[model samples]
Target: MADASGLELVEQALGHRFSDRTLLEQGLTHASAEAGYSYERLEFLGDRVLGLVVAGLLLARFPDEDEGEIGRRFSALVQADTLSEIGGQLGLADHVRAASGVVNDSILADVVEALIAAIFEDAGMDVAAEFVRRHWELRIDAVTAPPQDPKTALQEWSQARARGLPSYHDIGREGPDHAPRFTVEVHVDGAEPVQATGASKRAAERDAAAIMLSMLDPESHG
Candidate 1:
């Protein structure tokens, strides 16, 4: 409803009521908005909270899965893409207070974590875990098997073709120190070099390798 407040809609989407309204407000405030408070700190705490809950969910859901398999599933579930997708489904972007025209996967992902932290702070781990389960259950169920790590897959592909190992180089860095962006170039013998940007060098390398892998074998990547 257009008449409904942003916080109200967010609370509805999250299926939780906030005792301290300030937490919800802070969670929705972006760093660029110049709001005296922002979501960064909450996002940091929520990241760890999300990880622990997701790990517990995986262990309970797949008792037979070994640590490696569970770890892969956990990584996929907590990736920025996944979090942003979930945020979109919950209409979180509509409520985020950011500078005009500022929107990205990182922002959306950060706010989602911030909200989770707020919930955890308000109602403790049980409520926070339940909220995660409610929103993430379908995704967890839809995954038939743990997806292969893109970097590892790319390395195996290069080795199979006798290309030795792919090399990664940091080509550029930008943005603020707190939230820096890194651009990495990945080079493999006999193939055109590919580059990608991410919040960190490791993430950039993974992205570049994934792109290169997709280019080299579209069907496999798909």
Candidate 2:
């Protein structure tokens, strides 16, 4: 059985009540918990749902912009960092169930996605889209221009200064085989090397490069 108070709190945060409370409970469940009951499948469906809604929202909001520009905005909007930030705002970490007794940003982000799937399953696409628009509109409206890819931006910054390209080294890997976490360090010519972790090597490298960029010019990147 699901905890009534906890479900109520999550429903309030999501602004959508679930008809099948089990769906919400399953969505909040982590793989680390019960073997057969995890949010992975819901997350898979939610990922596509989120992408479609966000893409539609971008198209409607920026009718004059070309595909490339809208694509950039779409990427930024659906990135794990953005989802995790929204999850934190909703206090999802407190509600998610994990065997380790700790929930990381990735888990929180996944839970948020799973919750979106739950809403879609319980109600319909319209309700799911409305929920997404309400929570994500402020973020979408705040952007004056499409953001650059962190990796490309870092490379451009280095090349403009006649500095050699950034180098990324894989420092470590952890977690289960199905969900490995990678640690990567980005080294610039003169500055201190910065490290970051992610669910994949590419993501870790990208995060490291972003950190390096922020360190070099806090005003521009930060």
Candidate 3:
């Protein structure tokens, strides 16, 4: 296969190689990077599968919690950042077969879901669910902290204690139209700035501000 190396890398990172090689191949294919049969389709399937699995898990784990709590936790677990972080952790970047010039992590998010979808298709939902449980359950279970919108949090912090409103700038953009990645810089009124990247301009800006806040509150950032 053309992407044999990529396939091997995937198996290495995943700790299990696919019995049906084509499934793994499909998982590694991003529409922007590949000609056809991309991970987009798998991502769609995985999105639904993820929702089902998470909902079931949340119900079992948080028996006393209400619907709103489960929904929030599910949203947090399936968020883009969480997926991207999992992709990075699994070293998906090293194995992902994308088109030239598509270096952004946007594809990373879809690829994670696509891989899950592939696993579900190849082995079955039971197999895929267990894999997800091993990798995601603990993180999903530990919901001790309140979620804050990083951009809003930063803005309010600046307004309350800092000199003025925080400023954000689109520093750079990369990749094609379908999946352009943005780099954003956030500057506080009178403080040093922070920069980060995301799939959308808003996401990048929020991440940059979040990074800045983490610097300000290291103890709470975790």
Give the best candidate by lDDT.
Answer: 2
Local distance difference test, each candidate: 0.87, 0.88, 0.79
Pairs that clash in candidate 3:
33-98, 33-99
The candidate, 1 or 2, that scores higher on lDDT is: 2
Q: What ranges in model 2 sit over 4 Å off?
A: 159-165, 174-181, 188-193, 198-203, 215-222
RMSD of 3: 4.6
Sort by lDDT, top down from the best: 2, 1, 3
Residue lDDT tens for model 1, 100-165: 645666788988999899999999999999989988888899998998878888899999879989
Candidate 3, 44-162: lDDT as tens digits = 99888877887888888878877776766777788777888888998887767776645456678888899889889988998889878877888865776435577777887778774
Q: Which stretches of candidate 3 lie over 4 Å from their true place?
A: 151-175, 182-197, 208-222
- Residue lDDT tens for model 2, 1-222: 557999999999999888999999999999888647989999998998899999999999999999999988998899888999999999989988887767887888899999999999999999999989988889999999999888888898988777889889989999865457999999878789999999778779888988889889863454
Query: Against the true structure, what is every candidate's RMSD?
Result: 3.4, 3.1, 4.6
Two-way TM-score contest, 1 vs 3, winner: 1
For model 3, give the 10-residue run with minimal summed lDDT: 97-106
Reference-based lDDT, residue 220, model 1: 44
